[model samples]
Target: MRVQLILSEALSGLRRNASMVVSVVLVTFVSLTFVGAAMLMQMQIGKMRDYWVDRAQVAVFMCREGAATTTCTGGVANQEQLDAVREKLESPALAGIVRDIRFEDREQAYQNLLELEPDYADLVTADQLNETYWVNLVDPSQTDVIAEAFGGMDGVEEVRDQMQYLEPLFSALTVATYIAVGIAVLMLVAAVLLIATTIRLSAFARRRELGIMRLVGASNRFIQTPFILEGVFAALLGSLLAGGAVVAGMYFGVDRYLRERVPFVTTWVGMQDAWIVIPLLVVIGALLAALSAGFAIRRWLRA
Candidate 1:
């Protein structure tokens, strides 16, 4: 009987302020969606970093004939210069840092380029490609040391760390994630304020019933439960809407659009990611609604 009465009162409150309730729902929906997107972006960055960091290699490009770089003073690297570089890399000083080393000649480099960019394969010739030593490190963090050691050497034209190319892309993604989080924070604040306003108005409209109940010796919790339930109901609805939107984005936007276009990114998001995000959004919405409604009602309920 008590649960039935509380439900009826909560339903009455929602109907009495239908417009405000809808506004709260919409605001919560948008806010939680941004939160979910920001979280998924962070997860994507983690996956990409894990996938790429392990495979990142340092490329030591030896000088080729007719190269324009100042480091190519000898015009091109001969067998003696190439042997010297190999000896230095295999030296005891770099033994612990360098895990594996592979040599790629100009012809091999041209073939590899052709495989990646077949349409423009004819534009590049073997003579234009530099022989390279590919060094894989046990720890990719020591890339700078490796680069400094090989760079400016007699036969080396340039030392390029492949990981450097990925840093800017990840940094941009991280900035975008932060921006989304900021927007979500603002929207959540708006939602909380709207919830508080709605509860205050509902309390005012029902002041007479509340006054009579207080006179009859109703407890504070008994009077406040219905209003709190009203806020919780609206928030839960909004959370569901936000969860749906996030799931759609994960499926249609990230999986269908991005995965199909960029097949090379093997570590893409999936439905399981949404499972984690949905529960968190639901909890946040419930807490925001409950706290705001409870706080707003305290002053109005006082004797």
Candidate 2:
């Protein structure tokens, strides 16, 4: 009997403030979607870091003809200078860290440059390219020490860490994730306010019935249960839709399009990740709605 009464009251409250309920649902849906997107982007960043960071190498670029670096003041690195630098890299000081070392002569470097940027291939000559020693370190975290050891050395123009090239990309994604989270937070606040407004309006519209119930010895808990349930049901519906949207994004958007296009990415988000995020979103939605309804009723529906 209590369950039926609560359900009927919740249904009546929802029907009474239909537009506000729709607003709450839509707001919660959009908010949770942002939350899901931010989470997925963070996951992608982690996967990319875990996969690619270990593959990163330190490139010790030798001086090229006409280069104007302080370390390259001796015109260009001669073959003797190049051999000396290679010997230093293979020295005992870097024994455990140096896993492999590959040399890129001017010709080979220029060819790689052309392959990377064919349109500008004819614009630059071979002498303009630097001879590079690609140093594969056992651990990527030792990149700074390697760079410091070789950067100011004779015949070396600069020591380039491959991770530098990847940092900006990951940083941009992190910023995007933060932006999504910010928007989600704002939208969630809007959802809460809308829920509170809807509950207030529902309570006001049914003031006469509540007054009769109060005269018949209805407790405050009994009166508040239906209003809280109404908000919880609406928010739950929105969260369910948001969860579905998140799963669809991961499957169709990330897995299908992104993974297929970027075949090199071995670690991609799957349904399991989506499933993990969905339940949390549902719980958050339900809590937001219930808390807002309870607060609104306590403030406005005082006997």
Question: Which prediction has the highest lDDT against the true structure?
Answer: 1
Q: What tens digits encode model 2's per-residue C-alpha lDDT throughout 1-303?
A: 999999999998999888988998999999999988888888889988988887888999999888888989998998888988889889999998999999988899888888989997769999888889999888889998888888788889999999888899889989999999999999999999999988988998999999999999999999999999999999999999999999999889987899889886778878888888999999999999999999999888664
| Per-residue lDDT of 180 in model 2 | 98
Off by over 4 Å in 1: 68-70, 119-122
**lDDT on C-alpha atoms for all candidate structures:** 0.93, 0.90
RMSD of each: 1.9, 2.6
What's the distance in Å from true for residue 243, model 2? 1.3
User: Candidate 1 local accuracy as lDDT?
Assistant: 0.93
**TM-score of each candidate structure, all chains considered together:** 0.93, 0.87
Segments in model 2 whose C-alpha atoms lie over 4 Å from true places: 95-99, 119-121, 125-127, 260-268
Candidate 1 on 126-219: residue-level lDDT in tens? Answer: 8999999999998889998888898878888999999899999999999999999999999999999999999999999999999999999989
In Å, residue 254's CA in model 2 sits off its true spot by 2.5
Please report the TM-score between candidate 2 and the true structure: 0.87
